[model samples]
Target: MINKIVAIQGNHPSKLNSETDTSVFLAHEIQSKNYKIFYYDPKDLSVINSKVIASGFFIKFNYKDKKFFKILKKQKLNLTKCKFILIRQDPPFNLEYISATYILDTIKDKVKILNNPTSIRNVSEKLYSARYQKFMPSTIFTQNISEIKNFFKIHKKVIIKPIHSYGGNDIHLLNKFNSKLINQFIKRHDHIMCQKFLPKISKGDKRVFLINGQVCGAISRVPKHGSFLSNMSKGAKPINVQLTKTEHKISKLIAKDLKKENIFFAGIDFIDQKLNGDINVTSPTGLKTLYDLSGVNLAKIFWKELKA
Candidate 1:
C-alpha cells in the first residue's frame, strides 16, 4: 500500500508570503486532497543511522484567504515514511542544497522523490540548456574575459547572468559592454552565461509551465516600465497569452527531455521564441500567477500528475 504522507523540503511559513510563493500553493493543493502535508527545510535533513530523516511540521492550508496555512502538527520523520517528497526550496543551490539531495537520495528507494535527486543534481539549471543551443539565443558559458568580450562584440547587446543564479537576481542587460564591470561580474560568478539581448523582450518573455512533460498553462510577464527584467518578483505584470507554434514546439521538446531526466515538473522561458537558456528546474514558479491570469490551476494538475 502507498503511504499518504507528502513531505515538502522548503522554507517555513514566516519566510513565505502567499502572494509570491508557489510552494504554499502546491502544498495547500496537496493538503486539501487529504494527504498529510509534512514540511521541512533543506537544513533539517539528515542521515541518521543510515536513515534519511527530517524535522518539521504536518501542515494544512486554504488559499481562499490571504493568510493561507496552519501547522497541524510538528515532528521528526524518517523520510522513508513519506510517500512522496517535493523539493521546493529556492535556489542558489549551495552546499546545503547539495547535502540535502544526498540525504534524500538515500530514502528515494522508499519515497518517490519528485524530479529525482540524481537527475536534479546532474542537471545545472542554466548550463544544462547547452544541449539545446540551437533552440536558444547566442549564449556563451565561460569564465574567460576575452570570450565574453568577443561574444559581446558579435551580439552587440547582451545579458549577463550567473549559471547558478535565479529569481532574475544579478542579471544584467547591457547595451554596450563594459570591460571592468564584465571582469568584476566574471570574478563574482564562477561560470557566467552571457547571451544576446533580445530587444523583443520589450514585448515580454513568456514563462511556460510544464507538469509531467506537458504544457499545462503559460503567462507573459511584461517588464515594468523601462525594465528589461520580466520576473514578476521584479514588478513585472502578468498577461494571459497563448504560445506560438515555435514556442510550443521548443517547450515540448524540453518537456519531453526533462521527463526523460525524471524531472516531474519545470518552467522554461522564451524571448521571441528563442530559448532563454535558463531551464528553471530548481523551483519552477508562476503557477499561482498562471491560475490568476489564465484561470488554469496547474497546481491542481500538479497533484493529479503525482496522483497525490
Candidate 2:
C-alpha cells in the first residue's frame, strides 16, 4: 500500500505562527484529506546507506485551538517511502539550506517534491528576477561600495536589502548616503540588492500567487503607519485586491517562466504596477493571509494543481 504521508521540511513548530504561516495552512489542508504530516527540520535530514532519512515527528494542526499543533510521535523516517515532500522552510539561504537541497536531490525522482529541489537551488530568489528587470524599479545587485554609492547618487532615495534574507529582516530605506552604514551593511550581508525607493509604497504592494505556472490569486499588503516594508511578518495588513491589466500581463509572463524552470509554486510582488524584484521561490508565503482576506483559497488550488 502507498504510504499516505506528506513530509514537511521546515523549522520547529514552536517557531511557526499557524494563523499566518503557509506551511501550517498547507499542512492543515492536506491533513483533512487523510494524509499524515511528517514534520522535520532541514538540519535533521541525512542520507543513510543510500536511503534519505529524516528525524521528525508526525503532527496534526488545529487552527481552532489556542495550541495550534500537536506532535504525535518522534521517529526517524525514510523520506523515499513518502508520497510527497514539501520544502517549507524560511530562508537566509545559507550553506545549510543548500546542503539540505542537495540531500533532497537524491530522492526527488522517487518522491514528488514541490518547487523541485534542484530548481530552488538553481534559482536565487532575488537574482532570478534580474531577467525581468525592465518590469522592475531601477535596481542593482552588488556589494561594491563605489557602485552602491553611484546608484544611491542617481536614485537619491534607495531601499537596501540582503540578497538572501527573507521576511523583511535587515531591509533598510535610506534617504541619505551614509558611508558607515553602507560599509556595515555590506559587511553583514555580502551581496545586497539596492533599488530606487518608490514613495507610493505607503499605499501598499500587491502579492500575486502563482501555482503550477498559473496566475492563481493576489492580495494587497498595506504597510503599517510609517513603515515602508509590506511583508506580513512585519505589521503589514492584508486586504482583497484586483490585479490591473498590466499586473495581470506581467504576472502571466512570469508564471509561465517560473513553470518552465520547474517551480511548482511562487509569489511575486508589485508596487505601482512594476515588479518588485523579489521572486519568492525558496519558500513563498501569503497563502494563509490571502485566504483570510479573500474567500479565494489558493491552498486548495495549490494541491489541486499538484494532484497530490
Candidate 3:
C-alpha cells in the first residue's frame, strides 16, 4: 500500500509566491486530508540501485498564516513509497527538465504521478496546441529567418515566443519586422513560436482551469498598463470572469483531448476567444488566484477529483 505522502518535485519554497502559488494551495488542501507533503527540488532527485529517491523535507501549509508554509522535518524518501508525486517544476524545458521526466517515468506506475511523466515528456506546451490549430491565432513554429520575415509581411504585427519557456519570459512583440532582432531571437532560442499579435490582449486573457477533463473555473488576467503579457506573475491583475460559449466549447475540446493524453490537470488561455497556443500541462497554475477572485476553491476540486 502507498503511504499517505505526496511528494512534490518542484522548486524550493523560497522561490515560490506564497500569495498565488497553486502548488502550495493544493498541498495545503491535501494536507487537510491528513496527507503529509514532502517538498523537494529537481536537483534533489536521484536514482540509486534502480530506486527513485529524493532528499526533501516535510512541509505544512496554512493560507491564513503570513508565512503560509513551514518546513517540518527533513527526510530522504523513496518516491515509490508515496501515494502521489507531482511534477511541479517551472519550465525552460531544458535538458535537465527532460532528464527529470525520464527518471520519474521509471516509477510512474508505482506512484500516482499527477501528469504521467512519459505523457508530459511527449507533450510540448506550445507545439501540442497545433492539434487544434483551427482554434488558435495564425501561428508558425520555426527558426528560419526567411519564413519569419515572410510571416511578418503577411501578418504585419507578430508576437515572438521561445518555444520552451514559461511565465511570459523572453516574449517579444514586434510592430515591424526587424531582421537583426529576429535573427538574434532565433539564434538564442533555436526554434520559436511566432503568432499574429492579438490586440484584444490589452483588455485581458482568460485562463481556464481543466481538472480531470472538466472545466472547473476560469479568471481573466488583465495585463498591467503598457503591457500585453497577461501572465499573473508578469503583474497582470486577475479578476473573476465568465466564459463565452465559444470559449467554453474550445476549452471542453482541449480538456477532453488532454484527459485522453493522461494529463490530469492543465491550464489553457484565450485572447478574444482565440486559443493562445499554450496548453499548460507541466505545473499548470492559477488555483490560488481563482480562489481569491471567485472563492471557487479549485484546490478542493483538484484533490477531490484525484480521490474520486
Candidate 4:
C-alpha cells in the first residue's frame, strides 16, 4: 500500500506563523487531502540499522485557532514510510543544514523530497544565481575587504547580504563604505553578496513563484516607508501585481534551469526588472501571502503537480 504520510523536516510547527508561513499553508492543504502530517526537526533525524528515522510528532494545523497547531502524538518514525518529505527549515545554511541534507540523501529515492536534498546540498541559495548574472543587477560575492571596497567605489550605493542568511536578517544597504563595518561583517559572515543598490526597491520587488518549473503566480512587496528591504518579515507589504514580460521571461528561464537541477519549487525576486540574485529553493515562501492577496492558490497547484 502507498504511504499516506507527508513528512515535514523542519522547525517545530509551534515556531511557524500561520498567517504567512508557506509550510503551514502547505500542511493545511495536504491535511485536507487526508495525508498525515509528520513534523520533525533536522536534529531529530537519524539513521540506525540502515533505516532513516525521525523523532517527532504527528500534528494538525488549524488556521483559525489562536494557537495554530496541536501535537497529536510524539514518536520515532521511519522516514521511508512517508510518501513525501518537505524540507521546510529556514536557513543560515550552516553545517547542521548540510548534514541533514546528507542524511536525507540516503532515502531520496524511496521518498519524494521537495527541492531534492542533493540539489539543495549543491545549490547555494544566493551563489547559485551567478549563472544568470546577465539578468541580474551588478553584483559580486567576496569576503575580501579590498574587493568589496572597489565594488562600493564602482556602485556607490551597495546592498550587503550574508551568503547564507534568510528573511532579511544581517542585510545592509551602505550609501558609503566603512572599513570597520565591512571588516566586521566579513568576520561574521565570511563571504557576502554585494550588489548595486537598486533605488527602485523603494517602489518594491516582485516575488514570482515557480512550481514544477512553471511560473504560477506572483505578488509585489512594497518596502515600508524608509526601507529598502522587501521581505515580509522585514515589514514589506504584499500587494496584487502582475509579472512584466521581462520578468516572466527571466523567471521562466530560471524555473527551467531549476527544474533541470531537480528543484520542484522556487521563488525568485526582481527589482527594477533585474534579478535580485535570491533564487529561494531552500524552503521558498510567499504562497500563503500570495493567496491572501489575489485568491490565487499555488498551494493547490503545488500538490496537484506533485500528484500527491
CA lDDT of each candidate? 0.87, 0.93, 0.92, 0.93
> Which 10-residue window of candidate 2 scores lowest in summed lDDT?
293-302
Residue 282: error of model 3 in Å?
0.8
Which residue pairs collide in model 3, if any?
A: none
TM-score (C-alpha, index-matched) for candidate 4: 0.98
Q: Could you tell me the lDDT of residue 137 within candidate 4?
A: 92
Sort by lDDT, top down from the best: 4, 2, 3, 1
lDDT of 3: 0.92
The TM-scores, one per candidate, come to 0.96, 0.98, 0.98, 0.98
lDDT value for model 1: 0.87
- For 53-96, candidate 3 gives per-residue lDDT tens digits of 99999999887888878899998999998999999999988889
Off by over 4 Å in 4: none
- Positional deviation of 83 in candidate 2, in angstroms? 0.8
Q: Which stretches of candidate 1 lie over 4 Å from their true place?
A: none
Clashing pairs in 2: none
Count of backbone collisions within predicted model 3: 0
Q: For candidate 1, lDDT tens digit of each residue in 136-234? A: 989989999889888988988899998888889999988887989988898899889999889989899999998899987789989999999999889
